[model samples]
Target: MGGRRRHARPASADDLLSQLGRLTARVREEIEVQRARVELAEALQRGMLPSTLPTAPGLRVAARYAPARSGLDIGGDWYDGFRLSDGTLAFSVGDVQGHDVEAAAYMGQVRIVLRAVAAMGAADPGEILRTTNDLLVATDNPLFATCLFLRFDPRTWTVRTSRAGHTGAVWARADGMCGVIEHAEEEIGLPLAVMAGEAYPVTEYRFTQPGALALLTDGVVEGPRFPLEEGLAAVARVLRDGVAEEPETLADRVMEVAECTGHSDDAAVLVLSHDGPEACQTAGAAPGIV
Candidate 1:
C-alpha cells in the first residue's frame, strides 16, 4: 500500500499578530475616550465655582481655587460668595468625599441646594446647612461633604458662621496676631449626609479691630508628611507677618505657603476683611475675581 502523504498544519503567526494589533488599537481608543471624559469633568467643576465675588458695602473678598496636580483628577473642593437682598454676604467652602466625576456632580447639587436655601431667607448658616443635609438625605445621595458657611453683615460688622466637620476658619487681627477659630466639641457637628437628622450649630464672631477671616478646605492644612497642627502653625506665622493689603494678595500668600510646604491635595482660600471703624476712610477695591 502507498504511504500516506505527510500533511502540514497552517502557520498561525499572522493571525496572532493581527489579533494583537486589534487589541492594541482598541486599548488606545479607549484611553482617548477616558481622557476626553476627564477633561469634560474638569471643565464642569470649574464652571460650578464662583466666577466673581460680590462686593459687600464694607468688606473686601477674594478667593482662590486650585485643582490637584494629578491631571484630570479634579476633586470636590469649592468656594462661593453672594450678596442676599437683605444685605447679607453669604460665603461657603466645602469638600465632598471623592475625587471623581460623580463627586463633582454631587458637589454641584449640594452647592445649588445651599444657595437656594440661603436665598430663601434662611439667615442662619446652620439652618441652611441643616436644610441642605435634609435634601441630600431625602434624595438618598450617598456622598457626604464637610462645609463651612458664613453670613457676614456688612452693616453691623458681625459674622455668623457654621461648620460641619470642616477645618476651622483663620483670622488675622489688625494688631498682627493670627490664629484658628476654636469651637466647643459639642458645637462642631458631623459632616453632612452622615445621618438624615443632623443639626449644625452656629458661631458668631464680631470684629472689634481691622482684621480678615479666611475660610479654607482641609487640603490647605492636611498633607502626607505634615500634621494638621503644624500646617495651622505655619499659616498662623504667615498671618502674623501680616497678610497683604489686597484680598487677592492675601489669598495668594496663603496658597503660596501651602505650595511651598508640598501639599499634595487641592487647596482653596476665601478671605473677607474689614478696615474697622478706625480705618473706615480707606475704600475697598472694586468687585473682582481670581
Candidate 2:
C-alpha cells in the first residue's frame, strides 16, 4: 500500500502572516476597484441629467433624483427638461431596463439621442418618440427604456404628450384635484428599442386652468413593500394636497412620500407648475422623447 505524503504546513507564523497580508491586500485592491466603478457609474448618471432644469417665464420647474439604496450598481432613472428649437418646453422622465454601470451608460446614450432628435425640430410628441426609437434600434443596443415625453406649448396652454411603456404621469388641477393622466394606459406604446418602427400615439390635453404636472420614474411610486397603484395614489394625494406649494416645495413633498416608503429603487421627479396664462409669458419649446 502506498502511503500518501502529507504536505507540510507553514513552519512559521511569519509565513502564515505574510500570506494573510497578501490576501488582505488583494481584498483591499478589489474593494477599491469596486468603489471606483460605482463612482464612475454615478458620475455618468448625474452627467446625463440636466445640470439645472431649463426655465421659462410662467412655468416653475424643479427636479430631484435619488439612487438605489442597496445596489452596488446605479439605477437608470433620469429626468430632463429643456427648451426645443421651436421655442416650446420639452420634458421627459425615463427608466432604462437595468441597474448597472452599463445601464447608466446606455441611459446616457438614449438621453443624448433623444435630445438630438428633438433638437432637429420634431414638434409632435409621437414623431419625436418614433424617431428616437428608430435611432436607438439602429444601434442594436439590447437595453430598452420606458419614457414619458411631453411638449408644453405655453402659447396654447396645451400639452401634446406620448408615453412609451412608462409609468403614468400625474397632474393636479389648480383646485387641488389630481389623478394620473387620462387614458395613460391605453395610449402607451412599446418601450424604446423594442421595435424599430413602433408608433407612439399622441395624447393631447390643454391646461384649461392654472395647474401642475408631475413626471416620475416608477421608483417614486413603487417599492418592495408598496403596491404600484397604491404608491401612485399616494403620490397623487401628495400632489393634490400640496398643489399650493411652489414647484420646488411640491417636488420635495412628493419625494418625501417615496422616501417614507423606504423605496429601494432609483427615483426621479420633475414638477412643472403654472400660475396661469395671465401670470406667465408665452414661451414655446417643443418635442421630447423619453
Candidate 3:
C-alpha cells in the first residue's frame, strides 16, 4: 500500500497556452499547404487551357470553366478550340478521371496529345480521339478521360462530332428549336485509356441557318442527387430559349444550372454560334475563315 496518497497537479496556464499555440501553428501550416496545392493545380489547369479561342468569320466561339466549390477546386475538366490546317475550327471538351492535382496534370497531357494529333492531320473527329487514346494508353498511367471533339466547317455549316464516354451535345436552330445530340447506347465508345485500341464513331449534323451548338463536360449536368437526364433537359431548355443570345451570354445562362444544382465537380461549357452566310457577307468576312 502507498504510504501517502499521490495527487497529480493540473496543467499550468502557461503549459496549456504553449500546447494550444503548437496545435494552432500545425493547423495553420496544414491550411497553407492545402492553399498552395489549390493554387498550383489551378495554375496548371489554366495554363493548359487555351488563352484565346480561334475565331472565324461566321462562327463565334466562347467558353466558360468553373472549379468545384468543394474540396480543392482542382479538376480534370478542360475545353479547347483551335484552327486546323484546313481552316476548319476544332473544339473539344474533356474530363479526366480525378479531382486532384494529378488529374489536372493528366488533363494537360491529354489535351496536348489531342492537339498534337489533330495538328498532325487527324482530320476525322473519330480518328483524333482514337490516336489521342492510343498515345494516352502508351503512358500506362491508369487514368481515363472522356472527350467530345467537334469540327465545324464554316463554309458548309456542317458539324462532325465524336464522343468518348462523354455526354451528347445540345444544339439549337435559328427557328428556335433545340435538341440534345444523344447517341445510341451501342454507338458510344469507352473513355480514352481503358484499352489499347477502341473505335469512336462519328455523328454529323448540319446547321442550315444561324444557330448555336453547345459542348460541355458531365459535371455541367450530372451531380449527386441530380439526375443526368434532367440536367440535359434543362440545358436544352436554356439553348432553346436563349439561342439568339450572344455566345458568352448563352454560356453564362447555361452555367446557371450547374451553380444552382450545387454540383461537387467542375463544370465547363464551349458554345459555337453561326450567324449564317448573309451575316458573314454583311460583316465582310473572308472566305474559308468561317
Candidate 4:
C-alpha cells in the first residue's frame, strides 16, 4: 500500500476555536478603545459649562447656547454670572484660544481659576481683567482669550463695563432704541495672555431705569461666508424691536432667527433687563420654543 502522506487530524477543532477567539478579542478591544474615546470627549465637553449662574437680588438671567450641529465646537467660549463675595452681581463672557476637546477642558479650568481671581480681585471690572491676563500669561498653556466683564447694580441700574479684546454688546432702552455700548477711548485689543500685567480700562453706563442688554459672542453673528458687520447689523435690527418687557422672550426670538437664518456656529444670547416684576412675570411666556 502506498504510504499516504500523514495528515495531522486537520488542526484540532479546539486549536481552530482558540485562533477565532483571539481574533474576536482583538476586535472587541478596538471597539472598547473607540467607545472610551467618545465618552471621554463628551464628558470633557460637559465640563465646559459653569455649574450654576448666581442669582443676585432683583436679577433675572436667561442664557442659551447651542454648539455646532456635529457637537464638538466647545471652542473656549464661556459665560459666567455670580454674586461676588462683595455683594455685587458679576458677569463675564469670554472666548478662549482654540476650539477642540482640549480647548474646552482648558476653557473650564480658565473659567474657574479666573473666577476665583476675579472674585478676589474685588468688584473692579478692570482689575479683574488685568489679573486674569497675568494668570493666563503665567499658565502652562499660555492660552489667550477676549472677554468682557460687567458689574451692574440692580438697585441703581448702573453697569460698570470692562472690555479686553471682545465684540462689544448693545443696550436697548424702554424707548424703542438701541446702540452698541462703547467704552472710553482706548485701543480695544491685545488678547489677555499676550501681555502679562497690562492694565485694562473700565467704563460705566447707567440706564435711567431697568431695560434690556444683549450680549453676544462673535459666533452669534459670524459664520462661514457671513459678513460679520452685516450679521451684527442684523442683531442690531432684532434689538431695534426692543423687547424689554420680556427679555427671555427676546432672547428666544433672536436665537430663533440665528438658528433658522443666521450663521452656524456655537451661538449664545443673554438678555438681562431691569424691566422689573412685570417683565419677569411675562418672561416665562416669552413665546414657546422647544
> Which of the two, 3 or 4, has more lDDT?
3
TM-score of each: 0.85, 0.88, 0.91, 0.75
Better of 2 and 3 by TM-score: 3
lDDT of 3: 0.85
The 0-to-1 C-alpha lDDT of every candidate, in the order given, reads 0.80, 0.84, 0.85, 0.67
lDDT of 1 at 157: 67
lDDT of 1 by residue, 176-216 (tens): 77888877888888888878788899888666667777889
Quick one: best TM-score, which candidate?
3
> Which residue segments of model 4 deviate by more than 4 Å?
1-42, 56-58, 70-73, 184-187, 260-264, 276-290
Model 1 spans > 4 angstroms off: 1-27, 278-290
List, residue by residue over 1-290, the lDDT tens digit for candidate 3. 86997899899999999999999999999999998998899888988899999878877889999987786668899999999999888999999998889999999999889999999998999999999998899989988999999998777566788999998998787787777886788768899998878999888766656778889988888887568888888888888788788899989988988975669999899988777665443454332121
Clashing pairs in 4: none
Candidate 2: pairs in clash: 87-284, 87-285, 88-284, 88-285, 88-286, 89-285
Candidate 2 lDDT over 66-113, as tens digits, reads 988775768899999889887899999999998889999998888898
Candidates 1 and 2 compared by TM-score, better number: 2
How does candidate 2 score on lDDT? 0.84
Worst 10 residues of 4 by lDDT: 281-290
Model 1, position 87: C-alpha lDDT score: 88
lDDT of 4 by residue, 34-101 (tens): 66654564467566665666654555677666554434344667777877776678887777776666
- Model 1 accuracy (lDDT, Cα): 0.80
